[model samples]
Target chain A: MMFFEGSEKKVEAVLKPGQASLRQLGRPFWAKMVAQANAEILSSIHNDDCDAYLLSESSLFVWDDRFLMLTCGTTTLVHAVTEFLQHVSQDALAMLTYQRKNEYQAQLQKSSFADDLASLAPHLSGNAWRLGHLDGHHNYIFHLDRPYCPEPNDATGELLMYHIKGEDADYLRSEGQNIEQIRQMMAWQQLLPQFQFDDFLFQPFGYSMNGICGDRYVTMHITPQEDSSYVSFESNLPSEQLTPVLNHLLKVLQPQSYDLISFNMACALSHATGVQAIDHAEQALPIGYQMAFQHFLLPSSQVRSADPL
Target chain B: MMFFEGSEKKVEAVLKPGQASLRQLGRPFWAKMVAQANAEILSSIHNDDCDAYLLSESSLFVWDDRFLMLTCGTTTLVHAVTEFLQHVSQDALAMLTYQRKNEYQAQLQKSSFADDLASLAPHLSGNAWRLGHLDGHHNYIFHLDRPYCPEPNDATGELLMYHIKGEDADYLRSEGQNIEQIRQMMAWQQLLPQFQFDDFLFQPFGYSMNGICGDRYVTMHITPQEDSSYVSFESNLPSEQLTPVLNHLLKVLQPQSYDLISFNMACALSHATGVQAIDHAEQALPIGYQMAFQHFLLPSSQVRSADPL
Candidate 1:
């Protein structure tokens, strides 16, 4: 089914429900939405009726009346916008953020993130994608409400993606990499000790798991098919928790290459400093593995780095 | 439309028309077939009703009663199998070859290559795909007739694909690569002095050109989008002609990483010898660039290489 054909998208939506939890209402609602969005339903419950949804392309988490859905491939996600409206009252639609990699031209064209934002918040002051290649890396940021508009000197929570290639890709796709075994070991290890999670191993191939830590969530999808094997990790954790969490995931996955998207929310780190921190955190990478690309996206008033953008 | 979204497919069919050319009959027939296949047309004529057919996803060439259609994305190409039957008398069909990379599970599942071949020639004995990752290099070859059964002793044409990443990917996607300009210069430079060709620079991005030298042909497609810039080259030329031809194109394209598919057909080159030839041919690559991978598809009778597969 090409679980990794297109870009994996992550959407975060805040809610205004009077109740503290929407656990009971979230599962069936998402299954219907996935069917409507033309995605295959693999699972909708992780723990005994816990509200976690896993589709072939991506996953979704619902908590504290807030919701987050992440998926990939040529899914008709725009339809989910209207469906989201049906689930939440107008007042409960507090905020929304949609982000995707800048690949897949037709899929991107099919999206209406800007129009959807305008309809949801008519007077919004910030809307637009930060799209372009900076240095040797590509950055794509789509925002609604509080746009990805950190102050020039502010170093916000960073978001990053890494693409594993070469020997790393070989190891992960090989049986010796023992991904299925790793998944079992991880379940016991509980990388995030505080979170309750759900996992699924696709018949004969692929692996995915979703974890919930209070209001925040983290998910991973491993496409272990021969030619296009890939693995992705995403979370909405605080900046302080980024390195340790990333390190733990890296240890398990051992991806050959990874594309890191650091959405620096409101921090004060400089470009060089940020890269150095990432390099140190990922120093577990084996020898001959090179940091072949690096990029930085700064606010308009920030002093630009001398490197080519 | 993401012309490069899925794997690009190439289908070569030979016919036994009485006339030397199919020029008068080819265009309208393909236009009808494309309409039936539900594809949008971009151009079918190169210069004043020329015989080339270019669709949003693929291109077609008709000459000497032979046809080659190359298309990418999700086009229902299997339908063309029946369409070919209608176009020719029972005895007029000569040979057919269909090629696609081992990506796109949905599309690959949709293909009826093996089924069609079985119906066409039930007694055919050879069939198998060259599928595996050897020494960090992935290779996939499925055949209709001879099969990619290169004996360890037989030096069949070798197929190789290299992925350029990081800084190299950055440089190739930039306008500074001057590929379109190189195409113009090459038209006059006559790098392959024996061929005549037509070229098109996609509006604001990408470049594609088709060249014919007798029954042999060469084609190139470069997608320069920032996030997924890629270049592909394919030909039916002999092994003796490959090195010089590849060197010229590499010099002009300067792709950071290239995937070369050398289909070793009925040759006697040993595995190590073939890799040595490729390494020597690519010596023009700048310093610090490395040959990070090597793989081979040896026949069952031949001993496999010591490298991990």
Candidate 2:
């Protein structure tokens, strides 16, 4: 739920009672209204104008401009949307958006997880177009079927992303920067590291050469996954070789080697635990890199700026 | 903060220990390590593999890596950005976002707020663009001077919002039906009643369109402000007033209203809130000759039905 108070202090004061607690039978009906004498003065919504930079997929619904989350399960679209509006008002920040897989028009033709168990097979060799739903609300939604993705996890598969809002997208369309300018300034090549997961094994997979929708924005286009054994390999990696390579890399790369913050965590997490530290951090830091340049193996005795190099 | 523990749960369980303030910080050496670790984590230096979506302003710094936020006396660009990231990450949603902003190259250009005010003699608007440097994490920031559009609080004299993120933004862009489709479907020539604030002296004078940004998603553009009056005059109505009129209409016309769960809330917030709820609702929704049917309103309430009229 997103609650838009003017200042941080006002936000804190107004959202003092704000929380997401699971209720008994129905949805979590956390109390939204917190009226107190000392409630921080906020910009009045009345007569105040709000302008939103929206793409085409954007639609605004009115439901008393409230911020609550109990509206997630409205069977009827109207009730559901009204409920979402209320939730949006409360905390647009932490909303766990959900929709029935079969309910969406786009998903109508798609087979169910059970019905398409054979279809749920992972891609082995080549690539596959991954059609994961627009991940979800700013909340914790759990337990979706394989139809969502061949992956095992729930709600946490955003390895590839696109730009949908802001000047970056607008500039890409309006200003029309040349390919050289794009390549040099933005370093578009380095943005996303190329890795072959079970979903896509194809090399040099370009994500939206042109903007995805009428030059409005960009998109991540992965090679399609045909019949394959994602299970044979651990997670997306082929367990036969990757496990050892990853383990070897972990053994060498140390934290505290760099002044840069994330690198320090890498060293710290590794030092704090062991090889497991690198594995543990994958959830928070999903992208990994080469141990030589991306990371350094610095033992404490000889741990210096030049030591890793 | 929103730790999405997928396969890396075991790793997360271990790395989570370092966050314990008391145990780690009790000793200076460990504290330094912890502080360093904290900084490292913030910097995003580790090129670990996970599905992370990041948004950036400047390509100079591939924040796919991380950086630090250190104050340089005055409120510089660096300070603003650090504060912005810190604010967004306060919630797990923002931290777990597939989207992020990058302005690592948006160097720390410090300008005193007092200095900005003291130069009021010239009343310069040329430097309005400089205000963009104030906040680093703002994905699509548009800063303006005060007094031009007042009453919405003058604290920062700026309005910044991050609208799209996660899959919501992706769907907004990648989908076939663009913004125009939704707009045409929703905004079916909504003719709204004359809107007012209190009496004839004060009323809404114009309609404004604002594009609010999230991560990759764009919400429909709509923002209408009420224009107040000090002197009496015989003024004609505004063609610009159409924005709000259409906004109120588009919201009330959503397909969710017809659904089983939403009819009530749909009927509630759909009616504009004013003194005497019953009278206002009555005027908005007539019994037999309902304004919904007689005037500018969508024919069908079902989003799937697609313009029944």
Q: What local distance difference test score does each model get?
A: 0.47, 0.19
Q: Candidate 1: TM-score?
A: 0.55
Task: Estimate, for each residue in B146-197, the C-alpha lDDT of model 2 and write its tens digit.
Answer: 2222121111101111112223223333424344443343342333222111
State which candidate has the highest TM-score: 1
Kindly give the number of clashing pairs for every candidate: 50, 73
Candidate 1: tens digits of C-alpha lDDT, residues A71-142? 766665646655766766545655555555433222223443434344445433333343322112233333
DockQ of each: 0.03, 0.01
User: How does residue A37 of candidate 2 score in lDDT?
Assistant: 12
TM-score of each: 0.55, 0.17
Quick one: best lDDT, which candidate?
Answer: 1
Error of 1 at A17 (Å): 11
- Across A50-78, the per-residue lDDT of candidate 2 in tens digits comes to 11111111111111221111111111222
Worst 10 residues of 2 chain B by lDDT: B5-14
